[model samples]
Target: MSLARKFATVGGATLGSRLLGFGRETLMAAALGTGPMADAFYAAFRFPNLFRRLFAEGAFNAAFVPLFAKEIEANGIDGAKRFSEEVLGVLFTVLLVITIAMELAMPLIVSTIIAPGFVNDPEKFDVTVKLAIVMFPYLMCMSLTAMLSGMLNSLHHYFAAAIAPVFLNLTLIAALAYGLWTGADPLMTAWYLSWGVLVAGILQMAVLYAGVRHAGMRFGLRRPRYTPNVKRLLVLAFPAAITGGITQINQLIGQMIASTKDGAIAVLQYADRVYQLPLGVVGIAVGVVLLPELSRALRGGAVKEAANLQNRSLEFVLFLTLPAAGAIWVISDEIVRVLYERGAFSPATTATVASTLAIYGLGLPAFVMIKALNPGFFAREDTKTPMRFTGISVAFNCLLAVSLFPIYGERGIATAEAASGWLTTVLLFVTLVRRGHWEWEPALFSRVLRLVSATVVMAVSLHYASGYLADWLTPQARLLTQLTALMLLIGMAMIVYFALAFAIGGADASMLRRNLKRKPRPETAQEEADTSVLPPPQM
Candidate 1:
């Protein structure tokens, strides 16, 4: 399969999920606004996501994929299947215990991890605690889901895992809509969303289970046991967890600092949702497809091929993500207003989120590049180097956020996020170069410069459109009207950018033209090619 095809398989599935998520958040903003309910819900949401990142998705994947790939290569199908079952057995027991314990300790977790939002308001505080307890169990279900996802990914079944998140968004949307229709309290609706998360995890796992079965891999857990492989996985995962924790540490630090200012945390959270859409789509899709592929290459002693995959992954990511970053930066306000300004969401909140979104836009490509690059290290089973770099980058983020927060407030948080993204990218590049893993190719550099130049043209054009829209902002303007205008303006900006990019040899014009020269499904075929993973072991 071609690289583009692989990306499309993952990217197309993920694009659906991201769009649904946008709808879910749009409804949440309409229903809850930036008030107490929003705060409580986001807080509850973040707690599970933190663990999900640190364990289920992050450290686990970093450590598990490479070993799984190797076991399949050396020990064959049954060996890899046994390894998976053993890992799942131990993970289920441990995560179940952790979930119950965390639920029991929800109050303390909320109070310390991100307390300031609810500290002065007892109602918000209590609601967050209860909601968090309901949501905490999601970790257990999702942990199991992640294990299934990892297995499917190792088997090159990226579609199932990529498509699974859509169910989560659909569940939440349905829950939120039901709550609204019934005229229930928003807090109750938030609790329903929490339960919806657990439901989604189950559905996701079930879907991947089917995929695994189709691929002729067994999916089940035995009674818990700490086999040597399990123990090795546990040991390897600890540092990988720290490496995974690095990205979230920026958010945690920002949340802590944002707590000092009224509404800042919620503002940051809202903007983050917008930022997460693209990051989740491109970054996560690339990471998921690349990791197991890199693992297989490294295990087979194909170092040069592994590097080539990295290089191509870099090219593919830069091709797609750089423009996305540019578009978001160009129309941050319109994007915010279109997705958010309804129900209780005010114009002021839109403005706040928009500015923060712009800052986040600046870092989007770097974030995706980091995602694509990290697999190179993880596939080599060298978690320590990335861990060290992540630790340093996260520390830099903390210092920058602390130094800037007093004056910049929420924007400081945004600035810190952007700075940390670039910081990590630079560190990773240096590490790769020093180790003789990565070096500049003139063609790649030239392509990147073209992308930047095209994006600059896009940004300048969008800036004027934004200014023109500002003239229409009046107290009497309806939210729908403002949002509609914003959408139209953004659409215009994109058309102009696409046209200019093609004219100037900027974007993926040549690729698109060549693709057009092929049959109708050419893009789809290319996407599938890019997503190919390890060949399943012989029966």
Candidate 2:
């Protein structure tokens, strides 16, 4: 499959999940607002979500895909199957250990780590602990799902893993619907969401397991064993997990700091869901595909192909994310109000979330670029370098957030995260260049500058369009009226950006066709001649 198609497959699926997630968040705003229950639910959920990214998605994809590809190459499907079962047994056992420990320590964890601020509110503290315990098992389910997902990605079956997240959003939405239908109180609504998370985790795993089986790689349960292979995977995965979850780590750091203020955690989460649309679509798609694809290339000693893939991935990411960042930055207030201003989401809350969203918008490209760039190291089995950068970023996030939070409130945390993200992105990019792992193409730089120009134009256009819609986008406007205005404003921005991108040489149809469409390998000189042309611009 063409890289663009692969990205589209995953990104399209992620786009579905993210869209459903928007509905879920909208419902959540109505059901919980930024109340004690909302803060408690989001804060508790962040723990397992953080671990899911670290242990399952980040760690396994970084450490497992390359090694799994090696197993396939060295010993075929059977060896790969054997390696998978071994890892699964250990993963399952370790997850149980972690879950049990976490469940037992939920109270302490919540009081100290998850939300120290809740301690002063005995009811909120207890609610957070119970909810966290109920949902901690989600970590186990998603960890197993990640193992299955890594296998599927290595085998080039992207859809199931990518689409599995839709179930989480679906289940949560259903839960919210039920809660609203029953007119459940905030506390009761939160319980529904927590249980929904657990159910979705199980459903998501089942989907991936089915995908793995359909891909013709079946595994039998094995007794827990710490084989040499498992041990090596652990060594690699420990660092990779940290590296893979730098964003989550930074969020958790922010969460702890934000918790000191009531509703700050939930406010950050509202803004987070908005920004996560582009980040999840473009960022997760790039990270999921790049690692396995790049690993296979390097493993076969196709260094140039690997470099080309990285270059193209970077280009494609910027093409999509730059304008998204622009739109988010330009109309953040409208976006927030249009989506979440009804029900318990008041105008004041909208203003707070909008500012936070705007700050996060500035970091969108860097966040996605970090996902694009890290694979350059992980694909080569150098997880430690990225992990070191992650550590540095986390430290920076902590220091900056602490220094600024008191004076600036939640916006301070947002600023810190954005700043930290850019720091990590620059560090990763420069290191890749210095280590000769990346080849800076002159054309790629030229295209990026052009894309930036297009984004600036689009931002200005969006800014003016938003101003024109200022009246229609108000809190007193009918929901449908507000939504229509927001859509038209966004539609104008997209039209302007894409038109400018093509007219100004930032992108072209031939480039899309070249990257998104694949042709059969030519088998003859005449065929090769017919196929001959300048390759698509990298990314």
Candidate 3:
């Protein structure tokens, strides 16, 4: 498949999921607002999600996909299918044990891991524990889903994996809708939301499994075996999991520190949700598709082709992410208010969330850059390098959080996050350069500089326009009209930015057009002849 088409397929599905997620969060804001109930629910929901990133996104797919791709390229589809079954059998056993243990220790895990926010309010703490218990099993379900996703992605079936997240958002929205129609208590509704996690996990796995089967692959419970393949998968997975764990730990630490300041945790979470939209669309889609493709190339000793693909993907991320960051920074406040200012989310809450969003916006490009670049290491099975670098980033985050929380409160926490993100991005770049894995690309740098100039123009124009529009956004003003106006202002800013970018040669519309118009280039089928630890054939 063409790279652009692949991205479009994944991005389209992800955007749908994100929009549905927005609906879920909006309904949640109306139902729970910024209160103890909301805090408890978020805290409860975070536990499984934190682990999901560690195991599913971070460890499992990072290790599994390259190996599975190699097997497919070497031994054909049937060989890869057997490898997947073995890996899945082992994965289920391990994740099941971990889930049961976590469910049993939910209370202690919440109170100890990231529990400072609940210390002052015992009731909220108790409720958080209860909800966490309900959601903890979601890790098992989602991890399995991730394995299934990795398989489908290897088969070039991005649609099913990308669409799986939509089910999650849909399940939550369905729960909230049911609660609203039935007039249930908010806390009970929050509980229902927790239950939806399990439901969504099951649905996501089932959808992907069906996709895999339709792709002419089948998986079943295999007799547990300690094959060399399984051993290598475990060996790779452990450090990879630790790497994912470190990143998760950074956010958990941020949460723990922010917890001491009431409402701070939720503020960061909401702002992150907004920043993550573009990060998801541009960064994640590239990372997911690039890793497997690059792995196949690198394994086949197609160093030039791998490097070319990496450089091209890097440019794509920088070109798209830079303007996205600018748009987010320019419209942070208006975006927050427009999306999240209903129900118990008052004007003050809007300002707070928006400010946090702006700070996070500053780091959006760096965050997405990491997503694009980290795959370079993972594709080569060099997960340890990224893991070590991520550890340093975690330390930077913890130190900043401690020093800033007492002075700047929640905004301070957001600032710390932004600072650490940029720091890590720079550090990673330097390390890659030193290792000769990456070199200075003058074209990419020039594009970034041009993007900076365009942002300045957009920001200056926005600063002027917002002054005249502020008066029409009074508290007594109709929220819908005011929100529409706010979006119009942002839309105008985007138009100016893009127009300036094109004029100044910061963005190449032809490149984007070519990317979009490209078609899929499928891999040539291989015979079941070899199973080496090295790479596969190039397309």
Candidate 4:
């Protein structure tokens, strides 16, 4: 499949998942608000979510996919199956051990690491510990799910793996609905949500496992062993793990700092959900599709092909991300009020969340660029360099957050995250250029500049449009009225952006259409020969 079609498959599914996620968050807002229950539930949830990113989605895939793709290319499906079984055995064993250890340590982790603020409230703290323990096994389930997903992506079976997350959002949304119907108390409602997370993990794993099987690959776990290929995967994965770990730590730092203030954590989570819609759809979709495609291209000695893929991915990302960032920045308060200012979520909380969303929006492009660029290094088996940059970014994040938190409160932490994201992005780009792995062709640069210009136009349009809808986008307004106005405002901004982009030659609708319609060419003999010798495993 062509990259665009693959991305569309993944991006479309991700869009579904994210839309459901917004529904889940909206229900959560109505149920928990920015209160003690909300704080405890989100804090507990963050622990497993952090590990999911570290071990499942972020580190493991970066290291696993390229090697997995190479195995399939070189040794065919059977060889790939055997390698997968060995790796799965080791991964399962390790994750099981970690999950058990974390469950036992849940109390300490909650009090000291996850939410120190809750320590003063013994009941709340205890609830957090229990919720975290219930959800800890989610890490195990999802790590295994991620392995299955990596396999599917390498096999070019994107839809099932991509759609799997929808189950999670659905599970949580159902849980909330049940709680609301039962008129459950806040603590009981949180308990239901926590269990919902665990059930979702299991369902997600099942779906992806079925996907792997449908793709005509099956592997049973054996006793964990350090075979050569497994050892090499671990070596590459360790640095990527550290890189992911640092990113998580940066987030934890922000959460920890935010925790000191009542309701701050929930506010940050709300804003995070808002910005993550775009990030998940565009940035993550690009990363997921780009990694395996780049691996195949580089392995086939198609360096030019690899570079072009990176450039095109960047172009497509900015095309969508720039206008998104601008619109969010321009109408953040309205979006927050329309989506979340109901029940316990007050206008004041909406304002705070809006500011947080705008700060995050400014960093959206950099965040997506990081996603697009990291695959370049990962495909080349150069994980350590990114790890080093991540370390630097983390250190800067801590320094900035600590320095600014005392002065600016939650916004300070948000600022630090945005600043660190850009730092990591710039460092990655410079390194890629120095390594001769990426270059800014004139055409790509021009489109990016044009996209920025178009976004500016959209921003101005949105700023004016938002003023006219200000009354409807308020807590006093009827919910339906707010929704209608918010949708109309967003639709108008999108139209303005696209129209301006097309006028300025920034929009390439034809390129997207052509890419979607393009068919995969058969591999030539030279291409086969070029990929025959896999690069030596980095010990």
For candidate 3, list the clashing residue pairs, or say none.
1-520, 1-521, 2-519, 2-520, 299-535
Best by lDDT: 2
In candidate 2, what residue range of length 10 has the lowest lDDT sum? Answer: 530-539
Tens digits of per-residue lDDT for model 2, 138-246: 9999999999999999999999999999999999999999999998899999999999999999999999998999999989889999999999899889999999899
- Each model's lDDT: 0.78, 0.91, 0.78, 0.87
Residue-wise lDDT of candidate 3 within 1-539, one digit each (tens)? 66777877888888888888878877887787778878888878888888898888878667889889989989999899899889888888888889889888887888877566697789989999999888888898889888888888888899889989999999999999999899888789988999998899888888888898999998698867889999887777766776655545666887888767667777777777887788888877987788788787667655555656666777777767776777677767777776777877777888888887888888888887887787777787777777777778788888898998898777777777788788878877887678666656787688778978988888888877877787656556687777777877878888998898889988786657653332222332121123223332111
Could you give candidate 4's per-residue lDDT for residues 392-452 as a string of tens digits? 9989999999999889877888899999999999999998888678866888788888989
How large an RMSD does model 2 have? 4.1
RMSD for each model, in Å, please? 5.3, 4.1, 4.0, 2.3
Q: State the RMSD for candidate 3.
A: 4.0
Off by over 4 Å in 3: 244-247, 513-539
Number of clashing residue pairs, candidate 1 = 13
How close to the true structure is residue 432 of candidate 1, measured as C-alpha lDDT?
Answer: 76
Q: lDDT score of model 1? A: 0.78
Task: Tell me how far the alpha carbon of residue 78 in candidate 2 is from the true structure, in angstroms, after superposition.
Answer: 0.4
